[model samples]
Target: MSEDIDSRRDDSGATAPAPRVAVEPTPQAPAGQAQPGPEAATPGAATQPPFNAGNPYAAQTQTVAHTVVKTKTKKLPVFLCSLAGMVVGAVLVVALIMTGALNVNRDAGTATATSEPSGGSQTIKIDAEDTTLAEAVSAKALPSVVSITAWSSGSSENVMQGDDSEASGSIGSGVVLDTDGNILTNNHVVEGATDITVSLNGESYEAELVGADTSSDLAVIKLKDVDAKNLTPIEVGDSDDLSVGEWVMAIGSPFGNEQSVSTGIVSSLYRSTALPTTSGTYIYANMIQTDAAINPGNSGGALVNDNGELVGINSIIESYSGSSSGVGFAIPSNYAVKIAKQIIGGKTPEHAYLGVRLGTVTASNARQNNLSVNEGAYVGEVIAGSPADEAGIKKGDVVTKVNDEQISSADSLIIALRSYDVGDTVTLTVQRGKNEKKIDVKLGSDADAQTSQGEETNTDSAEGAGNGMSEEEFLEYLRELMGNGGNNRQ
Candidate 1:
């Protein structure tokens, strides 16, 4: 019995205790309050909860909460870091600009506006005032400028010397003044020219002499078979308006150099100089002075204004070395137009002859001749039966003025008379024996008077009515009266 009891006890001890019924404690709202479905266990206490089928989503709620906490912890740092980086970059850029490391010109905006391209605007901004002047002048004046070439055969003397007998050629310039191919040039350019040719726009044609005034050093030529289409007439400007220091331009063939251009200002005005024409006559008086670089071949070229109008014609240059010395003289376009009009109208330009030989009235001449007027043209001799004699002008009359214009010297009177025609009437202010007298006289043609005088003298001498002198002696007497007595008989 004791052994069986002990075996049972051992079996009982080996067997697990009776399964304890697990009862979930109610959830406590507070520390001693009645609990709900389940109760919370105290710290370090173990509790068993019965399987109550309630709160099915409780486990899922806990998992979602835990996941949200982990996401916040990781993403917070990355957002803060990106924000900080952007702020730092912006600060650095501002600092660089503030420091003097960057250069920005304030005037860049204005310059950029000016650099824009012009769209078909006719107006252009020239660099200088004179540049604008040259542009305006060249545009209108270049068409009227013509190039001239003259050729003449060598003389018989040159042919017999075993040299080339070919004709020598020279080049100059001219200005087209009319639509009918009437051109104006210096007399020296066409003088002794046998074959004269005028060129314009690469075409050349033979020319004919219309008339030449040696006293004014002006000549007019006409081109055959040329019309208004080939000719560009120049606009005549007033030279009387030209002031000292006014800008001017010259176009010519300098040194036989074609289409050369030069520019300068008016150095002086109304300058008088002596020029000898190819006809052996001396042209004395009024010229427009400029520094426009006129050379030998530049003679007869046009001096243009800023508006490209013809102001003057390049006539002569005062130089010693046969080159430009910055002293150039031009015949005023005013006078040129007058001469041109006569030649173009088929009227021969006849200068008004005074029939009196005069000299410069210096202080010495005035005292020697007992003249009251100090500055006047002293009358040396007066031709009989001439205009002066017909007007009661005597040998002792001192001319102080012509019409209303004052006469500075004998050259001034000659220059003034060249501006008139043969039948023109002139009013002379003569100072005779301290009394000024005004006389109006009608001029006569010198050509007709000379021819008549030659015929009459020849007839008188041939009939032995005068001094019984030979033809040579009568010719010598006539030559002496014409103020050229020193040359031997030809």
Candidate 2:
């Protein structure tokens, strides 16, 4: 009833709901009006405008329109694609199952697939026989291998030093060389032994030293009053036949353990090292190197090849631990035989006394020194009253040959001289000025031979000439790696 009545609606006179209007498509267009085509009513096409109720005639001109969408054409392409994809998936699934689960390559006799390791190399197992060549060699050589016990009044300091007390003894191994109970072992093994006991095949016999050479580190001892009916010496093998990779076995008493055997390959050949034996310092040349575990007690033991032949004598080891560091040196059987033979013949082996300062005669030296031959030991100085001087050998006289052996270097002369006894006469082919002459000179004793070195010896030695050791305890040991017979190797 107030001033706000004019802005309000009248509810008493409210009209009924307007009738809903419906629109329809026109059947035809007037001459001047344009008409829609069939595409105008298609899905997602132009839509209709709002219906008009004020003009009934306008409503009558509208007609309802309907359009049908064809879905079969689109669905036909999808069905074909699905069928092709299912066939390809089945083929891939079958191939994967064959390789992963079936292990199909085994049935096809296929080669194994190889793959490189991530970081390091891959190894394959190789089949090898259970038996070794060392077994046969040891069996054949063990019978000839003997255990030696040395008793001395001096302090008990020797290789293979036994359980015997300081005032008692030492122990080592030796090889039997002959049927007469002669054994061959290192000179140091019985070096200072006042008494020696040789045990062979469980029978022990008293031994006497026959001959010992300190220079060569070798000695021969004899088993006194023992039965030699079944005794067989070791078989000697050629050391020259030893190749660097050939198999070798060591038969000896290591740490007083008798009949202990170790096997290895020849690591090297022709090694020269100065060793301290029972006698003195000796230069061992043309030696065999092996890793066959040569220990302190193994000294004077046998170093045999695969055929059980004695190729070397285990003497010294080059080590800092005072044990086998797998680097052991052995005396070549050839040199050992040569030394043993001289000592066994009741003659002391001495270096031949060629009293002259010698030099190697090269082609240059031959031309410069007016030498007749290009190779030989050249005489630089002739000591007065020596074998060379007494034999009319003068300075500048080149020694072309000694006896039947050629003298190429100074060492060859010494080696050739060592092969013979001191009193043995050797023929020397000498070149004086321009003429070649032969002179026979008797080799002198050790005392006289000391001055025979290439350089002038300052002092005269007064020692007597002998095989360095007494033959009373001299026994030779030799074994055949083949049949076990003669014991002498040198």
Candidate 3:
């Protein structure tokens, strides 16, 4: 025997089976034993056990005697007990069937049962809840989306000469603006196009460019010879009230696939970016960022909320592969509509401009220059007779905040100014030497700045002043101002 086991006993412990007991009802109690009366057998009586007094499965009450007898019988096997239980269940099921107690309805292999509530029974229509959020929104918005085809000059000659490869045409998307045949789209989409065609609801209509704002990358076009009843303008939502993580849908012609729909949530808000265009570096500010699949032809399409209201215009996508990488940006509807309204009224679109040459501050540079703050935009020069100069903002002043928003760099300050309209007054928090002060300055117009100073105004236009700088030169200038070394955001 091993030490781990108890080996005190000389032999293995084996015993015979215990005696069995049989219970039998007695006609009378034994001598000197008390007898149970009829009241003792009654349900809920004080003398009865509470659990068994009213139990339906309880056996009848009786005075019983137990007798022990020695036997050589073995315990029943599990198989025998299981078989007996199955037999009892089958018998009970048959009894229920005979008494009409259980009924199961099966139709087309689907089993359904009617249930009654405490008040009454009712009928339910499961199909009534089948409509989904995406389905409903798409139904309401698809009519407002239109596919655009732009034809550049000399395309008619190319077609007449049987030279399809030389035809100058581009595909894009647009949103219907009104019943009078006005459509909203990106300026880059229809830029320099001699002929513009709009395809809506299986019909094509000729369109003419109404106005184009290169700074904001927005344009308006009007359809010719189109019926007013055929147009459906989309409902616009308040982009200022939009919150991050809210559901949004992108309706556009991705890859020229008309009426393509994609869904995503708002990834961020109030984002700023710049894109290199033929005219200049187009500045996008206070943009709504989403993860929706915005592709090449999705520009100027609708970015709508779950309520089927247009919140943004799908404009730009940040991806290295030139395809959607789950990062896209849109122009807020409030600002886009403002520009559209200006264009419709035959007025040029205006952007807020600050007359200052700015540079970003760094820790080492701040220490070298003995500046009080290590972050914020460093004012290199303030234009004379400009808003900053009028407000006593001098050179060497670091702008720390614009209104309530913190300005961490030169690019941020420019982006912040782009959100406001011209002539709007804003409070700027400046760090001059060791003292901080607030100054109120009214913004000026970019259009006025360009016309008044011609090519001499080096003031900040937010997009590098449209001074005919090549793409490489503009990017290099942005690098120095933003302090991002050489990695241009565009």
Candidate 4:
């Protein structure tokens, strides 16, 4: 068991029950045309897929073909970097586990909810054959789907990169957004390409970068010489309206097969993960989780809903083996569209920044720190000029909620902030001592996501720079930073 440390005193010299955040920094749908051909087959693998009608994420003894990883993975912070590497190396340890069964009792109804957590329900009821859903969605979506081949001059990642090395090509996917040929895909797809092309309906056209935001892992590119009148802009759906268990589809070039389609259901919502960049990290917030078989080449493909509307950009998958283990992630369409529009307007996308180092409040830390709650993000150190600092967030402040959304972890805080545009002010509910306080903060702006990671890439800014920092070492570093960080103000 973890050590007990919840008996700490508050600044007011009174006992409290604040929660401590535990840092486990770890890491789509689509629709389109005709009924997908019979399930994809792998040689020397199972002759039949364990995934049949109604089974979205369960398979026993089934193995996928292994391939070399070509995409860039984020560099991890010191403390859990090795742990994270181990986690990534071991993919799909935990399933999203939804419990809101929609009357689909398997053997008859298919998926059944095993149990529910104290809060929130799970899973959607499947109504039709997976093939029928895949076929209808594929037919409706394939027309707008485009195969992207990006040429870069740098070293290659299986997915994408903006390399200036010897010119080479990488394959990804995208969706047509308008008659203007403005297409939406992950930024990594066309990031550093000297030349990019988009193929639709078997005709290829040259494309140019409109704008790309690495922060959200999204980008917008425009096709050259394509008639806007002939474009079939895809229908954009509301991700906020999505629920667990809803059927979804993914269409892309997985392993370079164009228009390859897979069917699954929404696994969970508002998921968070950080990708290592040389500068620091790219944090993906409010993401959609599915088991739609997103593979390396599907980086910028479409995650569409049953209505054949775009819901997310199929992006990363959680697997230790570097292959699709049926646990995949997507950039929520709302954020994708929000950033895409900003890029289209010729401005870099901006995310709301709090400028504070945070720690997760767990039961032990809550008792140790005398906190009132057993879950929340504990404010360790606030940046001097940051919005949170200006708003009076101080060291030791436990933030329990952001604009009424209960913050259960540090990742939750990041997820809440990602939903807002920079310059938008919001309320923060903080548990200070014996009383709760609501502070309205005007969020500040940070540059759109960048291509590199930074010095503070570890679990929290409070831990200082470098890799492999233990908790005791992190506390010592935090003290040193506080001593030199100036600003003794509460």
- Top candidate by TM-score: 3
Candidate 4 whole-model C-alpha lDDT, 0 to 1: 0.67
Per residue, candidate 4 scores C-alpha lDDT tens digits across 98-208 of 333332332312222111111111233444544465666676677767888887664334334554356666678897877778888876677677788788877889899
Give the local distance difference test score of model 3. 0.73
Question: Candidate 2, residues 1-490: lDDT per residue as tens digits?
Answer: 0000010000112122233558987667778754677655554454556667788567444345678887656788798999999999989879887779644333212111111111111122222244345655665678777888777775334424654445555567887776777778887678777888877878878889998876667888989997766466777778989999999999887767778899999999876533222233354666899989887677788999877778898877744335576887788887786667777777765554556655556677578866678876666676677776788887777777887778765434544566666578889898877798999988776644432321443323211121121111111100111112211112
TM-score for each of the candidates: 0.58, 0.51, 0.65, 0.58
**Model 4 bad stretches (over 4 Å):** 1-133, 154-165, 357-386, 395-400, 403-411, 421-425, 429-438, 447-490
Deviation of model 1 at 337, angstroms: 1.4
lDDT of each: 0.64, 0.64, 0.73, 0.67
lDDT, residue 49, model 1: 53
Model 3 lDDT per residue over 33-150, tens place: 6567765555443443345656779775744455699877556776798899999999998898888885443222221212111111112222214656787678777788899888
Predicted candidate 1 versus true structure: per-residue lDDT over 119-161, tens digit per residue? 1112233334244556656655666788887766763335447
What is the C-alpha RMSD, rounded to one decimal, of candidate 4? 24.1
Candidate 4 or 1, higher lDDT: 4
Model 2: residue 13 alpha-carbon error in angstroms: 99
> How much is the lDDT of residue 23 in candidate 1?
95
Name the lDDT value of residue 417 in candidate 3.
84
Off by over 4 Å in 2: 1-131, 154-168, 276-279, 350-353, 356-490
Q: Which window of 10 residues has the lowest lDDT sum in candidate 2?
A: 1-10
Which is superior by lDDT, 1 or 3? 3
